[model samples]
Target: MYLDINGEQFRILKAESQGAWLVSCDAPGPPRFVDQRELDAYPRAPAPEPCTAEQGEAPQTAAEQARMALIQPLLDNGDCVSDPAIRRQLAAEAAQEHGTTSRRVLRLYYQYIATGAVMKHKPRKRRPPEYENYYKRAIQTFYYSAKRPSLRDTYDLMLHQFFTAPDGHLADKRPTWPAFRHYFYDQAYHRRSERTIARDGLTNYQRTARPLTGSAMTWKDHIGAYQMDATTADIYLVSRLDRTKVVGRPYVYLAVDTATQLIAGLYVGYEAGEEAVMACLANAAMDKVEYCRGYGIDIDAADWPSKGLPSEVITDQGRDFLGGRMKELCLRYGVTCEALPPFRPDRKGLVEKMFDLMQGRYKPILRGRGVIEADAQERWAVDYRAQASLDLTQFTQILIHCILYLNGRRVLDSLQMSPEMLEQGVAPTAAGLWQYYAAAGKSALLELNPQEVYYMSLPRKT
Candidate 1:
């Protein structure tokens, strides 16, 4: 039961035939006995709803238990604990024993008595601003954009727009700059993704802020799902017919098998369009032994065994991959073509990563022999074009060597091997995994005529 005595509120702690004990509900104190006649003089208030042990309560920590134990004696003293001198002596004794201050001990005792639990003494949550929506609208209008203004500038603009009087003077009752800054950061913390996209553009957000939880292998079940993309090689090349003639950097197309992390096929050429893509597809469908032999390199079929058209090809939404020729080729070959969403290169990360590995392997040895340095674009930098020495054929041969090494010998530490493969002692190299899967009849390779695929992939004028 509760009572309203004058303006103070008290809760009934105990009721006896002679009198009743009441405690102040608003503050911590021991209960005081009041005569029945005096209690009847106060107005009764409706009882507050009962709070269960589990209601809005968290388990107490070790520190809270220790603190509560230290103050147990003071709380047991009843009304004597409210006396300043007596309470001070009790707090000092507990503080001396527990290595805490007397003030803290007294505060904790009062808190526990008022709330009935140490966990209920948490700091109160701050109230939001009354004009929260106005601040949010101002931030959205003047701050979260490609032309991002500073918070100070944003606040100034907001004041000019929303807090200006009709006479063009600033209103006296306006939010402070610190308040606006606090609210701005609070909103930004919660709307991180939305703020990044709005201020830095979607491409930048996808590249930097987006979470990388999914792997490229998630979309592939076998070796036939290939990720295809093109990148400009960092090295410059000369014309095949004349080594003295300096040609520009060539575009290199790569096809990577998602399941085995294998470089299925590659092409180095002057074009970055449908021609280069079709040529790469032709190379993938043909036997690698003959292709390496054309460059005067002899390799066993087992060394570079990846061949045949893939069941599905994943690529970015580039003009080369979205052209009519690409669609016609997929339709004729019964291949499913998947174009990734714009600015989402992580979808085809296998082929994108292959470009880096392929270029990094040869760049060190080929420096000053046509390889462009990182600062080539700076003023007074070396003329990388004049240093070009390797012709198209020589560059192609170097790339083939790198590809052979990657396919046959590179150890894949992150490869996930099945129990059967592990028991069979299958190596973790690309070729080892491919050969094992092929022998187990788990490969998705389609046996098509090499000459037919080559001729059909050739770009013809409409």
Candidate 2:
């Protein structure tokens, strides 16, 4: 009978009794037990009891001895399952061999496996928490300060802010880092454990800020289609990677449009210079050029006028934004470029959101690769090491997969519409798109700068 050797209730496939020997002719492949509690991933079923040696009873037969030997290895090796339901079945099998009560043998066997001969699990006491808040706002005063905060940096700040004693001296000192490291650095011993996951009780994972706006988009956005900007944060390499073996230093770039905030182009490349920027733009434009055409958007295959280019090109005034070939290219195409103020990221909010996405989903991919450099030197270092060094270029292939997944995957914010869905349905041809822009009064807004890559922010605030 198909039996789950761990539970109280079990199936009996075949049974026969001889004196005290209830032999199971159908206990397939030496009895097995999987505790559903420990092995939640495996399928669970009811089980029967096993045979056992009784008090003042005769010895077992040769077949019973053979079965015991086969099962002994499994039990000793930590196999036969941990699921309680299945354990009962195993007990039933043992009982069948020895003609004893399954429940009794199971209880004794379980106790032996649980601790061998030690104490069982005991509950711990709790105490009231000291400080409530952890994270300080990103400034000391009203003005926007230039601050670079990392995971460790934030942790240190939170620790000090919370543990600062009122005495200021050494009277009744606070607990040390060793005492509290478990919450942040502890590994889960079991699934579904109610473990605290923040860094020293600081709620760093969740955003506690006000909300801002825009975009009519969806996940239906085709792989080669949508555009995005940097309302994003994780513009860096994967954070949790083994930096000793592999390292990364990437520049952030984002592509977005006014309506649905779909990331048309996303990349983690060497430099955030003009070349990277151009590559990103070109890559995005290339995708747009491909996916848009299939849906009938008027992307000029041969010639693109600046006014008819993108409805709007948004960015902040970084060194990468306002120089050399970048400005020249934009001017030549008549694309209206809008740059955010020096200290105001809110002006170009989408890219900020993009950075947030990066820190969460994409940073762990590059852990352990130290020395986050920006050139081929980094690749060479990995090659020279050759042992722990993984071929990053090869590793980067999954990034392309992730991009495709993000593009094709239905974006929930799309209100049930996909990016591909929007692009496919919007059938404006190139000339028509141009005409629409011109008719929309962008001619007055187009600042023809042959050399300037960025457009100044809001009339310079007088």
Candidate 3:
């Protein structure tokens, strides 16, 4: 018997029955149970039969051979991993090897199919499930989740949200960070890297930051301070609110020594004004020498260093930076006050970079967690404004703390040295065993000259 299914015909009839309709697709079926009164009264559908393959119903003899030829490697090398190209080639080679002639591997693979001929395959070790899907999710989260997550962060996020646990387990078997990163984090590396060419925004203040010099900043022709500036750093808004409703108050100001690349001064530059810078300079002196925030080992308190002054103070020519009072103060102190032209912070590039590290790098991290609490915000403001009221006499003492602890303790990447490195000299390991021994003064290791240990390159264009 034959019946049509979706435009294809299948041989099917009643194969077996317990009642009413007798059925058999392949053979005679038992009689169906029926009421004697109306045994043949109702309409009946034919029972399904054991269908035999029509012309195109099954793969041709050649197709069976071809498929087997294609998949014979698992038979030979039980654990071999298959590449698509290699897999295809494997099939062709297997067909040749097995003597399956002139047919697709699928068509001729099973000509003499028998047991133990095909070996099974297993999933790859460290292979990701659905890599494209993970890529889309991880990349989207990385870009949207503020400042882009670090590679580790992106991986962690996926583990937390996407990966699932199977039932009957005591706890979910979370994949290790390495495994998660093998898929998502590494994929990001393939993308083009973001270019971060820094432009200097500082103005040239080589003319006369030195109130005491009273002449050309340098008698040497064209010899001037090479001021570099950078800006728009992320700064934590130290205030009473949970987070700022709008631009908040109390930002830390950090001015760095370009030549040395050490943070010269750091103060909670409240909003923006002369008071901010003066306060920062005070911090510089405090963090450098007079105070005891010794060299190395990562402790977190600020100290005051005695050496507070810089040869030049390069900054943007903002009103607060270049006002009469700031210029006058610079002249009095004999510090060259150089200002960059409007909008070009590159002139003061060193300090500008400090801003980037502070704002761009650190602030986003802190902000994401919402670190500033009410009491800290209050303390930050009170201390900042209070520093403003002190006269120059008192101001000097305040700056002492800021300079030694905060400014002098800063580490620099250029020389892999600390602010204390100049005064203390390089580690024995870095400058070499003897030099390290000399700087450390290990009795056997004689100490070096304070100035000579650090060779400053005069900023003179060589």
Candidate 4:
């Protein structure tokens, strides 16, 4: 005996004292026994009338005909259509015959079953948004401001400000909140940088919203171009003379080779300006073996191979880089000085990124030893200055190790290896790349006299 339960057809196989053994006629599964009491409790409904397709309203397009053909077998067998297992098997066979997925075949079957029209299988066209001009003007004027107003608040303000009658009464045909929100998000998505600059300010936009297109590898033909930049180390340092006195954070200057991504030079000190730049350049010109030895770090010359003067130095328009002393030194050494325009740190992104990479390596290990936490500026934050345990020399030693690790051991997955280098199975490390290129005589390193470089790098006493 067949009965419809909750819109699904089921067949009773046998009646027992306590329950009746039943199997679903609309879905495929093993026979299930239902309690006699529960069976009586279900409301009985006449089976739904079979969905029939309109006679003259046949499929018009090839896609519609194809969809109808895919679902025709399931429609022909009404009993199997109700049994999920049988239905799935039929759909899978149809899918394989038609070169389509079973899921797509099943979806077509359900679509035809519901509407009895193959045309319903086609996707509907998307309509363009009909946002009024006043709505967009209002969003631009009020929504994209430093005040950072919400979409709802902006809509409310627009209704009162623009969508009002001449006599100050609310207009009957104002834009809805839902429409305003949709339009705002649409505009924000399309004009992300503009929205960010207007709402969060230009600095925030430059830092987070600016589009990154080109890479520093654009200058990867040679190792002569060095990008120079300065940043204050996050950790506070104590004075070497007096361990009790907190000497504040040290200024770190790094000169990075664009082609090989090597740390060509570095300077960590309390001084800022031309003096620091000169000192860093002097270090870049001299051999690093003796410099490491001075810091009690014994290493092979090949370990820290980056040395000699760069052909061109790229820096931001800082007063130090723009000073006469810098110009004089660069002119004397025939080094091209390219100071980037204001608010354009993205031009020297390699050196800028290196600062973060170098600091991130050591900051985790030196946490309580004076590394400043992100929340150090917040109210009731820890006194990071008092936590200073590392002096200048100690911090320098740590920085040297970090630089050595980055140059010699750290793998740069983004580093583009030449065909020759790849053929030789060269490691994608800064030192590895530098050594490979230098050995090939493609190095742009100028072997300047150490004494002349040192004397020229010293601040001129007029």
Ranking by lDDT: 1, 4, 3, 2
lDDT of 3 by residue, 43-70 (tens): 3334232232221233346744445446
TM-score of each: 0.63, 0.34, 0.32, 0.72
Overall lDDT per candidate, in order of appearance: 0.80, 0.40, 0.40, 0.79
- Candidate 1 per-residue C-alpha lDDT over 301-403 given as tens digits, one digit per residue, 9 for 90 to 100: 9888988988888898999977877787778878888988988887788788888888889999999998999899999999999999998889999999998
> Which candidate number would show the highest TM-score if scored against the true structure?
4
lDDT of 3 at 408: 43
Write one digit per residue (lDDT tens) for candidate 2, span 37-143.
43333333423223222212322566434434333432554334434466566667777776767765654444333222111234764422442122223112111
Q: Write one digit per residue (lDDT tens) for candidate 4, span 252-287.
A: 989999988889898988888888887788778778
Worst ten in a row by lDDT for model 3: 195-204
Order of the predicted models by TM-score, top scorer first:
4, 1, 2, 3
Model 1, position 248: C-alpha lDDT score? 89
Error of 4 at 76 (Å): 20
